[model samples]
Target chain A: MDERVLLTGAEGRVGRAVLGGIGDAYEWRLFDRDPPAEEHDHEFVVADVTDDEAVRDAMADVDVVVHLAGDPRPEAPWNSVLTNNIDGTQTVYEAAVETGVETVVFASSNHAVGHYETERKPDLYRTDDDYRLDGTELPRPSNLYGVSKAAGETLGRYYHDEHDLSVACVRIGNLTKGHPPIDYERGQAMWLSYRDCAHLFERCIEADYGYEIVYGISDNDRKYYSLERAKDVLGYDPQDNSAEYTMAGEPKSDV
Target chain B: MDERVLLTGAEGRVGRAVLGGIGDAYEWRLFDRDPPAEEHDHEFVVADVTDDEAVRDAMADVDVVVHLAGDPRPEAPWNSVLTNNIDGTQTVYEAAVETGVETVVFASSNHAVGHYETERKPDLYRTDDDYRLDGTELPRPSNLYGVSKAAGETLGRYYHDEHDLSVACVRIGNLTKGHPPIDYERGQAMWLSYRDCAHLFERCIEADYGYEIVYGISDNDRKYYSLERAKDVLGYDPQDNSAEYTMAGEPKSDV
Candidate 1:
């Protein structure tokens, strides 16, 4: 096998974008709870990530897993997050350990630290507050969905801590089409361009960190995140920025 | 009321040390699965932390909780660690949120970061590598028991981030008395003197930090952890060190 990689949630928007970018880089084994419309890469495995047997089977002959299979709704209930996100992540990690997978790129979200926006609002986005959300800051999720994402990040931490699995948690910011929201201030400040997202995660797949959390955003002028840590640790270099589209963007009045 | 605190696991080793130190500082409502042998200075409630109703009933009038109720054995079975430690901790945090408690001083353990020792051993203690185990370092627990402690810390994080409950996680080192074994270098380096343990926890109740992870070791020449974070964040001032007693005077040699 030429660096076989398992891509869970291969049909989702983020997953598809990642696959579209790096699908040819490795021998891909696509996985999703529901089947995709078109064939993905080389192999496809349709199954729920929470199913232990299914995950274990998917890990066979695979060296790495881009685990993106979970309920992504911001308003998901605790029961949904518990089963789909938390338990599913635990199962994936245990199986990765059991199968001797060397690395995993967990799909952690900005929502993992979403409440920071309320505290870091308007000022960092539009007004002048030189503060930024670093990966080192403690997670403050705004909803149950964010809680699930935080749990996934912790699972990566546990797997790396216990099994020494190289894991990277990308606290992805808002991702927009073609480019970031051209005139939206907060979105532009937080937008992770598609090219940047794929390439940053590509760094995650290749970097050697015991366990790390890095933001996924382009080099945006309005970004309220410190990209220095990510650049120093993961060697991430984002080419695009939301600033390319607009100078005076709309205000985010969510308090 | 001057200040009221709920001390969980009032019978455990760490809990007893904390109780002995601050028994007079705050009006305590002590909780444990097994009641104490003698009368206490304040109210004592015999209740399991896993029981939400019991925890809630005992949480009333509590300003802060020194949560030391989970299974502490480093070699405990997975089932026990899961039910008693992980689930029980979730229950405690939920109950705290339900009762609107202000802060939680969680007793996290060194084993949460013990695997780092095995990987860099001999050098860490045997040789003078002096690779300090800073609180910022990602945990690499050596055992399932360590995983449980990590889970407890995450529970504290979730409660703090989501519900605005104040939390402080203390990654306690090896705690023993009379002296740390000189022959057992790991023990000596990681030893937490009794008074230091008590006083360090006393600071947990006294100082303020929204969410923090701090090393629970006194200022010792042989220490492998940095106490700067604890001192800066929690105002912790430890008063004892194992070096005060010669290692030859200690009974145990096993680390």
Candidate 2:
């Protein structure tokens, strides 16, 4: 598709992942609070997501926005999360609607439903356990950061209903680079390989929907989050599995 | 009970309703942006809900908080709702935890699930429909204000799980003083009398719950929201019914 996509927090890990995979796929308008260390293919706008005027300016002709700009700390204080994550997300959504941006792919986190893991613990993360949390479950944020992400998801829902904007919130899991966290049960269950991450977001941009929420994780045998919604709705075909990366963090070549 | 209840937005409708019914029951620390027109019952603190320092100061020694301070307008802009509703709520929750406040009774609205009314409209409002929306259903906010209320509910959930702060989010319906709305099918189905409003908050203070959401409408026959959770969990015994009032909204003398 020849869409003019605005990637907020372009310097962030997720933004970079998308860029590395599909930088030439769309006309990119990269936005971040700080300028990139090395620039390249797309037009970049260095501005805080909370700055409505700057955000609105960048959103002028955007078709889709992959909004990943926020204070991504699980232990973030109320002030930081309120300002950077919650307020900033609201600004992005409002500006997107104002500038007539078609779709917004919000980067929601697993922390939005983190408390579920707290209760279930070892059983939930184990390879044998089959219990799964689809997007249908109510939000039970573990912290202020999670609360802000949930708020962002809610905002997307609101904007979609109120303004007819298409929104897809991706509740991203343990997104470590190259390999999943070594020998961590919880990490293994919720791991999202870099390629899968890029492909999931690509589906977000290409998919047609009103308001949707799908878990962003690779196919894993020890998973608690169901990837059925993502596959069925977004046609997200994730190739890499956390099981491929062994307990010692080495990639297993053969069956 | 002999609790020191700090009622924020004390001069507002919900606050006034609570005070009108149970003002003398507690040691009241009434805080609001505007001072009451003529006050005589409790110690009042005049400050905006957005004023964190003032809110924190007023929260000291408070047992429970009935946080109703927010831009209650359904058509509220992003800026107003963002500041007054969302951020203000976060401050209240954070301060409640900081000051060792026992519970927070958040005044969430029926608008949090208003979209359910959109398609099922006219028919859903009928007595024969039998379709009810219990508190268990996910929020489907119809407006920005509703979105903020949903966010507040989510905040309460987060605070409850992470900090162990007891919370009850009352998804209040049409709260009309004295009687129910006449001739309006939707209004009659979700009417909340002033007496019930006061009693609900009273239960929020008296009863115990980890985290919950209860519809705050009275025991109306033509109700769309289920009062099962409220009655069972919070000991909410509402005495009034919208059916008691005539279509003209006048109370029948004989009945």
Candidate 3:
């Protein structure tokens, strides 16, 4: 509610989703490398996450940090991921610890464990497949970008254990704006609705977990990521399901 | 056994262990930041692992790369780990892929999953306790150094999946020269004898695996890390056990 939260990568898609749904929930400090397109009620700080002094300054009075800043491309080069994702994440964690920030809700991606889908593909995406990755599994990254995300998760674990920071890594899925991707079974299976994303992050800010990894997908019938940890730990009750929509990305009721 | 092996960090402890025992087994190309104090048969190249061109050059005509180069300190700073460990590992993986290297035996650390011992401490170190970390579990790093190792493991996973380079991460325990650690239950529990260390790495080079995380410890009776994966996959048969040593670290037979 009244806790001052720092949202890095505030110009990204996930940032927008979080803000659009829960814009007025918390007193927010929006941090991004790019300047805001339009003005807002929240204090927008234009600075890169890699800037240690800037990040520490921004976290002066913040209670929580929703760290979403990084190179989001799955095919990003090693240097880009190392600098933006891995180094930037370490900077955030260090800053949080120094400034006595209570919690950090890291925006890890499905790509962190993307290689798990290599052997089990179309079948795993279907509703009939009961196999699930519930965040307890080791990261089997498929790319350099995924490696960086997994690195961020490991950094979170370190900060939590050493510094007593309450850290939660949300392995976010495909987050489209209005609905899930059309005819993409994998996307549909791991779809995270805008509202659900916001609510899950809200729970992250509000919850009291020491260190946790939870999938950030909605309650979908055709899902490979189990949401039990998220539900139990963060009290996240997602409203949308990808199965409720038609194969063409339209709501079944609308069709 | 005559594979042209590139042993990174050839001047380090693990390198010494490998070279001491199995030095005659392979045609070796030793790569290290520090020049060797004494050298004879092997072609020694003194270069930092972070140096991309040097690493790539070192990989030329190399069949197997035992990549042990990095910041070896468990309490190393973030920058040190980032540059020497994480970035250096990426460089090795990239070079291996480019040079058509067959396998990379990564030197991961027990520190990568050190936090697992937080709840179950002294008890977990005992022979009576059946608790174990089997390498399939997610990394729960306790320090920046450990985080870097975990990051390296993720990088290996990525290289194996995307580039089809065989990778085996050896989560090495506390490797001592001749005997188990003295008066330290935790260290003794996961002690890795020098000969066993060399033999285990030899197995890593010989055996084939797509992507694996195996504990690199001797056959200790009071072990927390399970050696089943190593035994099954890499045919690692360690002969040393800490239980054979006295509490003061002397050999029971000699005493």
Top candidate by TM-score? 3
After the best TM-score superposition of candidate 2, give how far the Cα of residue A27 lies from its true spot, in angstroms: 2.0
Please provide, for model 3 over A3-38, each residue's C-alpha lDDT reduced to its tens digit, 9 standing for 90 to 100.
999999999999999999888999999999999988
Query: How close is each model in CA RMSD to the real structure?
Result: 5.1, 1.5, 1.4
Question: Whose TM-score is higher: candidate 1's or candidate 2's?
Answer: 2
Chain A TM-score across all models, in listed order: 0.93, 0.98, 0.98
lDDT of 3 at B174: 93
Which candidate leads in lDDT? Answer: 3
**Model 1, position A121: C-alpha lDDT score:** 71
Which residue segments of model 2 deviate by more than 4 Å? A253-255, B253-255
Interface RMSD of each: 3.3, 1.1, 1.0
lDDT of each: 0.80, 0.90, 0.93
Determine the TM-score of chain B of model 1. 0.93
Count backbone clashes in candidate 2: 0
Residue range B1-255, candidate 2, lDDT tens digits: 789999988888888899998998999999888877885578999999888889999998999999999988888876788789998998899889988998999999998888878778899888899999998877889898898999999999989998999999999999999899988988899999999999999998899899999999999988999999999999999988998888777887773
Number of clashing pairs per prediction, in order: 0, 0, 0
Off by over 4 Å in 3: none
Q: Mind giving the per-residue lDDT tens digits that candidate 2 earns over A143-198?
A: 88898899898888878877888999999998888999987988888999888999
* Ranking of all predicted structures according to DockQ, beginning with the best and ending with the worst: 3, 2, 1
Better structure of 1 and 3 per lDDT: 3
Candidate 2: Cα lDDT at A113 = 94
Put the candidates in TM-score order, highest first.
Answer: 3, 2, 1
